[model samples]
Target: MTDAALSPLRGLAKLRKAKTRRFSSFDRTGGNDDRLHIEPGETVVIAEHAGAGIITHIWSTLACESESFLRKIVLRAWWDGEAEPSIETPIGDFFGMGHAQTRNYASLPMQASPEDGKAFNCYFPMPFASHMKFTITNEAEHDLLFYYYVDLELHETLDEDMGRFHAQYRQDRPHAPSEEGRTNEQVLFGSENVDGKENYTILNATGHGHYVGVLFSVYSRRRSAVWDWYGEGDDMIFIDGEAGISVPDTIRKPDPRIGPKAKLIADRAESVPGANDAWPPTLHGTGTEDYFNTAWCPTQTYSGPYHGIIAAGGPNWTEPVTLYRWHIEDPVIFHKSIRVTIEHGHANGRSDDISSVAFWYQSEPHQSFDRLPGVAERVPTFRAPYRNWSAVVNKTRS
Candidate 1:
């Protein structure tokens, strides 16, 4: 880990052999043309590197006439000449915000800076063994004015234990509810979920790596007797495999004369379904607000280092909200696989516009992603909720 500037220890300032380098959109002929003009339907290779290295930072700013340009433009990265990219998502969503909108917010690993957050920055460490490439594809109508930098360090060879950084986008333009014609109480909590098959998936990855973080955005589409609060959903994360606890037979098999600890472990294992029959959840949380480290259905925006609600909705969730949780200090580890999911509304009851960007690190040979949503679908749509008082948000600015 790199030491902080305030810390007494100087880690990187000491004996680091990695040489610093950067790729930027600078004009070659010594003129003011310090930006690239990317035409519509054009894909531009932002950076390409040979040999082992680690990308430490990425900074970019874009200007286009179309409002949905953020969603239309895609960012992709490949490591070691992989057929499929390790990092892929809409340009706006890749910088830690979603919904094709940019706003002022900051996080430990990523940030959208001031001036209405037009500047996007990312600090995730992306290490490549043999080769690395990053590209941006503009699928919008108008041409793109883009300025960016890919900062990195060149090394003779990277450590074998280093994992490649990855990010994948997924969405459900208002997911389908559990059952129609159900009362508010039934929709909220009356149902029982034994298998968790009906939950909304954030990511289903097959690899040996750690899940670092996720950015989740939601748009409330309907008014409910439950007050249109869209965060009753609980977060459930399945590690290794699904359905049941995955462990060696001796650890959970029926055995007599086992120690107290071993017997308790066995009994707990018997509580769930068969081991291979299902994907067992290793981490489970309370309501949606709780999972993001907030309480009482937050309607106010807050940005922190690890967890934050950059764009909170109106009262009763009348609009959209974008929240994030980075597990830099507490990453979820999995040996074989991991599945991250959450209930739409208690027991997967409510249907709302849900989308997410799952960010993690894994070894090579990762699965290919599903087809990215079209430009129309990638941009968001909202349903105006009932009577959000206009005066409540009128702050007394100094």
Candidate 2:
């Protein structure tokens, strides 16, 4: 036989390796009924793999009327028989939607498709050694019906240095506002933040891993009298370094005898300490919208593979909004630990409902997660009053 003809045949033989075959929902039912009906308060273990493997894709569709059902239904996953789940978040938020609302959006690792964004898909590669388990907990009072297919590939063995996927959800009903009577401008401009102690924490983990990104949502509760912008906060990420030294220990406290300008300079120069002096964050973002890859008070919805605003609160920012930012192209790497946080408003001075799902990959035996709040607490209750904030501002300022 000619060498050219033999070369093509040789390539086919190498591609037929037994360890590279695909196993998915199609294989489970042999192409028959594939949907699953979940009762309220019930937990279903959807997929289980006994050896090294990687979940390549996840597709699911669910029907539920409760607007809050998105936050009520929780998804969790365990790797290597860990006692605590490494992935836990409300299904909708986990899928890229927030505030239990769905709409069309696309990202590198996740996407919500057509038909009113009912079709949720994820493309993150979740690698597990020994075994992996995925489950869904229906916390709604009404039953939920869902159809899903988990596409995975079982390999003879995973690489020795593979990190497991993880996701954690958190919420701050109303990010405690600053002292009463403070004007929005005052709150946004009158702060010296050498320390990020009060910033809203997205993820606080200790391990060898890299942060992928986060799915964030906000429900504005700022009264119409104020400039209702929720993104003046800066993103402060502490990765494998000291967050900062405490102001008291780093520099002399402001002296009353000093002039206002000198005192201001002193305050501005003071440093803030974080959880500890261990490893400080290496990544920091200028502002909320800046971190999400947008700027100058975004009011329109847009989506991309890396970062986008899925929901832009209506005129004058009087609506709930959700945004996603995946670091696939620029993953935040860390060797020892990481603490991801951001300000609620400039210097954490705004009170707005905020929730987020932080996604990352890390070595196994991760720190156990705190108990996820019950359904009642997870439900988003802050809805902006239906009024044009612009009118309120014009009347108050004019």
Candidate 3:
């Protein structure tokens, strides 16, 4: 096949034998009332399919009674009847921005659309062999008026080569400025990061799969009036056996696509210290901004198909910033395990509010995720809520 055959549109010339379907929250009475009402602390299963199929698209918008509705509302999904959900995260985060807020930004697989970014859409291809389920839980204080549509294609058979979709949300508000009487310049930049042990972890998964993307958000809880640039931290990813998977290379399954595979030296002599242990990781990036495909300290918002900055923070990066990097064209493959991390500051120094939603496809049963935080903990907190955002706008006007 020529390179043209690789184009997604090229397959349209041939007809397929799959039945397309959609599950929506439509009024059964055939009225214009096309919304689902979910009371406080209620869980609703939007769709459930029993058979081989692939969920191709999902679109949703909602009205909630609480201000932190995005974080209070949670989305969960299961494939092939796994007791644990393959996907679980806050609604706003799942749509591709963070801090329990939304604005217009479009990624190849996900988007929070216009009308002020209230519309949420996802285009990830999720395949299931026996069954699939999707649910939404409203942990908000008040009721919810939700509108949604789940689109999928049904088939008699599916290839086992494809893995299931997984997305996880995580947050840490652990760092604060030093009280050791140091200048802001020294506090932010003067530190040595030897190993990435103290970095903010984005994804730590065990299985045969590839990491596809990251939705990283940073909120500054700066207590001092100084430069708050936290992007100096480097991005490091430990692959396979390097991530501390003691499994031998002989037993692990080969990756579906052709590429590099992790090889473990299972027969290490007890006499040799740290024999052949890999260091510095297989994937390392220059800085936090560099990993997200931006440079020279982002000061504005941008959204592209692969990588973009959705919420470029203000003055000295003192506010909150949202960035996304999707490895659709270049997924980090791992046969046994993968550890994706980035420093909070150069050499693990500054502590800022950091959160992320890592999305990928992995063979089931996947690693168990840390317990999702409650509403009180998951709610996004802001440090620079400057009204009219004059600093950012006037910076543009000038």
Candidate 4:
């Protein structure tokens, strides 16, 4: 829509080969009847299940490669009821949910023994009545082998306290002038109580930690609210016991260097749940990098901060491409089901572009899920998947 550079592909249905079967109710007592299959370089998934409450299980695997950078792979599913699902286990720590060592990033793919592979199980529980679906894709850029294991297998467990925890409170990166003015402080964790009241208390123990920012998200079973709804930028969660929720007194100061031409947008803003930094704060700079990804060069010329343009060159190369598809299923209420697929393509950095002939569908929206990119608002009434942005690489011809 905006042109191949910003959003390369539009209205391209990469999700081919549709299939489905009726659900006969989950057997929480034990056993699973749900299964899915994927061929090399293919995408597959269960779109969505509609209603008040439902459960889903998913499994996936990536085969070994001779010269590839993949060792082990695990699927990241959305937390059923919240914005920030759970803290991601640091690459090497292996302390959070989602099994698989960060080393798996290297080791799994080195298994050239033909039998080398990767896989995992994901369990989802819906608090309210809702339809659900499980999905997966083979994104290895090479041939991959995978299988799906799913079905509503209900059971009671003493370990229930351990699965799918939500966030209560989080600390974020100190924005802008503050970074240069103050000593760093550790962020505390937060969570909501049973009465639906949100609460966050700082974890003041001194230790080494990374401070990008923190997002405070709340999850609920009712469709009255979906996940990650940002009223402004990010909802501002206050600093505990700090004056005016202010920074340490030693760090606060006014810059006398304010020039005559400077402008103020808003005195202060709040942080949203699952956002990158803490709330009621200023960012390090103008947050301009979020707009332009210096990581990739743009071929086409454009002069607006909000516009995304891409470019590439090369004789026998697959030019960078973007894919698109829409959900044919109805609004995803609590229990209704639906399917979504991703398209693919091969571009020669010029005129020759071979679009994807494949697509994958799934019920749970992916973290990498994104709104079909463009300003046209082509499809209304649909909640776009909020996916992580990818680097726009332009291939140079040899």
Q: State the C-alpha lDDT per candidate.
A: 0.81, 0.79, 0.83, 0.23
Residue-level lDDT of model 2, residues 1-398, one tens digit each, is 44336554575554433354343334355766566668888999888878988898999888876667888889999998898999999999999778888899988889999988889999999998788899989998888877787888787788788899999999985455555675556666445555678788898888888899999998777754656787888888877664434334355454333213223222232143334323233555779999999999999999887999989987666678888889886888877778888988876877788899999999977878878988888888865375565577778688
Candidate 2 Cα outliers beyond 4 Å, as residue runs: 1-33, 174-181, 243-281, 387-390, 393-397
| Backbone Cα, N, C clashes tallied per candidate | 7, 9, 2, 65
lDDT of 3 by residue, 1-398 (tens): 65346667876766779999999999999998999999998999999999999999999998997987898999999999899998999988889678878889988898988888899999999999999999999999999999999999999999888899999999997654464865556666655555566778899998899999999998876644444677888898877645232333255554334223444423322223322124555676879899999998779899899999988986657677899999999999988778898988766777788989999999999999899999999997765465555565556457
Best-matching candidate per TM-score: 3
Residues 26-115, model 1: lDDT tens digits? 999999899999999999999999899999999999999987788889999999999988888998988966888888899999999988
TM-score of each: 0.86, 0.84, 0.87, 0.27
Among these predictions, the greatest lDDT belongs to 3
Model 1 lDDT on a 0 to 1 scale: 0.81
Off by over 4 Å in 3: 2-5, 176-179, 243-277, 384-398
How far out, in Å, is residue 285 in model 1? 1.2
- All candidates: CA RMSD (Å): 7.9, 6.6, 8.9, 21.4
Candidate 4 residue lDDT tens string, 46-96: 344443333443333333351231212212223444343222211111111
Name the candidate, 1 or 3, with the larger TM-score value.
3
* Clashing residue pairs in candidate 1 (N, C-alpha, C atoms within 3 angstroms): 174-352, 242-278, 242-279, 242-280, 243-278, 243-279, 243-280
Instruction: Give the Cα error of residue 63 in candidate 4, in Å.
Output: 1.9
| Residue pairs in clash, model 2 | 195-272, 237-281, 238-281, 239-280, 239-281, 239-282, 241-279, 241-280, 242-280
Question: Mind sharing the TM-score for model 2?
Answer: 0.84
